[model samples]
Target: MASDGESPVRLAAETWESLFRAQVAVMRKLQAGPAFKKVALNEYDVLFTLSRCPSGWLRLNELNDHVLLSQSSLSRLVERLEKRGLVARMAAPEDGRGVLLKLTDAGAELQKDIGREHVRDISGLLGPALTAAEQKELRRLTEKLRNSVGARH
Candidate 1:
């Protein structure tokens, strides 16, 4: 049973639907924003992911794990980024068959530029709807949920 005495399964499903709808609503707005004109959302996601890596290089397979795209789709997107000179690819030193990826100088700069705008866009959308304390609580809850779901990253 849930805390309010409703069935646990029903509560879970309702909660999931709300969360999913919220994400979709926000994503649609963000996707239509000016910042995304420079690069598609998925491309920016790759750049953003690489920017967070403390290590200079991240393996392609590992990158695949973090992203929502299929492996073949990611491979194609990485190819496009490489062609645009935004990302660099190298063979993994330890494994001849493994590919490694990292952002180029241009990619890093673009990510920073886009990220600044993205944060502002998010703030404008969420700020009025949730108080600071509520935002903090939401973050905490989401992180807990993510952890509970066995995310390796």
Candidate 2:
């Protein structure tokens, strides 16, 4: 037995949980795909961030913030990427103590390839379930949620 007020609260919580689970499932499946088999997700994230930056470079702290990784984890990942020739670290010109990470040409090419595959995967998985209008609505609603949550922090 439940009151009418409780119904809306239960419904909202259920909806949020379902949406979160679905998102996680989709991401897991995407990561398991062939295109991602060779690269860790964090590595891809770091590469993508550098690709978006001017000169394909960003400060070590900025990369950590953008990728939400611990400084030690980021340093290890950068070391691996450097070994693979996918990224390089250089001392910042203004501050010799500060370091910047830049994506190599190979990293840029890999990002482009993996990004295309990711887009294709998303389109294939979700495009049929959502009409164009619904997709737009979802984007708007998600952005609103992001903004509201960001404002709180």
Candidate 3:
């Protein structure tokens, strides 16, 4: 039901819409930047995720949780990256059925190279739009929103 006056449900929907739209706008600008030319954005995403792993050999399923792609699609992308020598995969010792993935040295170097340029692009897009403090607040708010939803699941 629609409310004539502002309602909690309406406010929630409006907030979500604003957040999603802002993400899309920022993503489009980042996608067009030169950093992605060397590596497709999704591929870079996978590499970036792996680059952040504290230790070696992140499980494929674990990696999937961190990235935007579906399991099947991520599997294919990993295969392509493996072929290009950008990522490596192995059978999980603890779980025979599980697969583990890691960035190869080449992949690490590439991710680092692209990351520098990508950060520059991101700074250019966000620096002017929000102050450092504002960015920190936005990060905190988004993390809160994400964690709240994640906790339910």
Candidate 4:
């Protein structure tokens, strides 16, 4: 609700629908590529998250915040990666009760390999639809939304 006499801003119906449709369409295009042949998109999501961590590791709960999967599902995914030597799991040093997930050397290499192709795929799909300036603006707008959502927690 707006405070005092101020009014809250809202997206127009058409604008909202366009944004939603664009996102779904882009995601479909990105997920359809061969880059995810070796590892499923969900699995790649975990590996990619781990790759971004400076420590190359994160506690399970921490990882859960970054990925969309449920804890049980994430645990099972980690197991699959572990079985393939793509990730390693160990007890968190601070508290043995917590499990820490770390991307292995092989995992990092794999993420980097697939990530290169993924970047290319993204550019190829969006290159014609958005110009350099529009892409930058889109990124800025999306990040703003993401930060706003993250701020709630």
Question: Where is the poorest 10-residue window by lDDT in model 3?
Answer: 1-10
Superior candidate under lDDT, 3 versus 4: 3
Estimated TM-score for each candidate: 0.95, 0.86, 0.94, 0.88
Instruction: Give the Å shift of residue 73 in candidate 4.
Output: 1.0
Residue-by-residue lDDT tens digits, candidate 4, 1-153: 355544444334555688899988988888889898898888999999999989777999999988889999999999999999999999988898999988989999999999999999999988998999999999999898789888998
Compose the digit string of candidate 1's lDDT tens values, residues 11-127.
989999999999999999999999899999999999999999999689999999899999999999999999999999999999999999999999999999999999999999899
Give candidate 3 regions above 4 Å deviation.
Answer: 1-4
Clashes of each: 0, 0, 0, 0
- Model 1 has an lDDT value of 0.96
Off by over 4 Å in 4: 1-16
Per-candidate local distance difference test: 0.96, 0.88, 0.95, 0.89
Per-residue CA lDDT of model 2 for 1-153, tens digit only, reads 246556777887887999899899988988888768768877889988999997667999888878868999999999999999999899999999899889888988998899888789889888998999999999999999889988998
Clashing pairs in 4: none
Per-prediction CA RMSD (Å): 1.5, 2.7, 2.1, 3.7
**Which is the leading candidate under lDDT?**
1
Tens-digit lDDT track of model 3 for 72-106? 99999999999999999999998999999999999
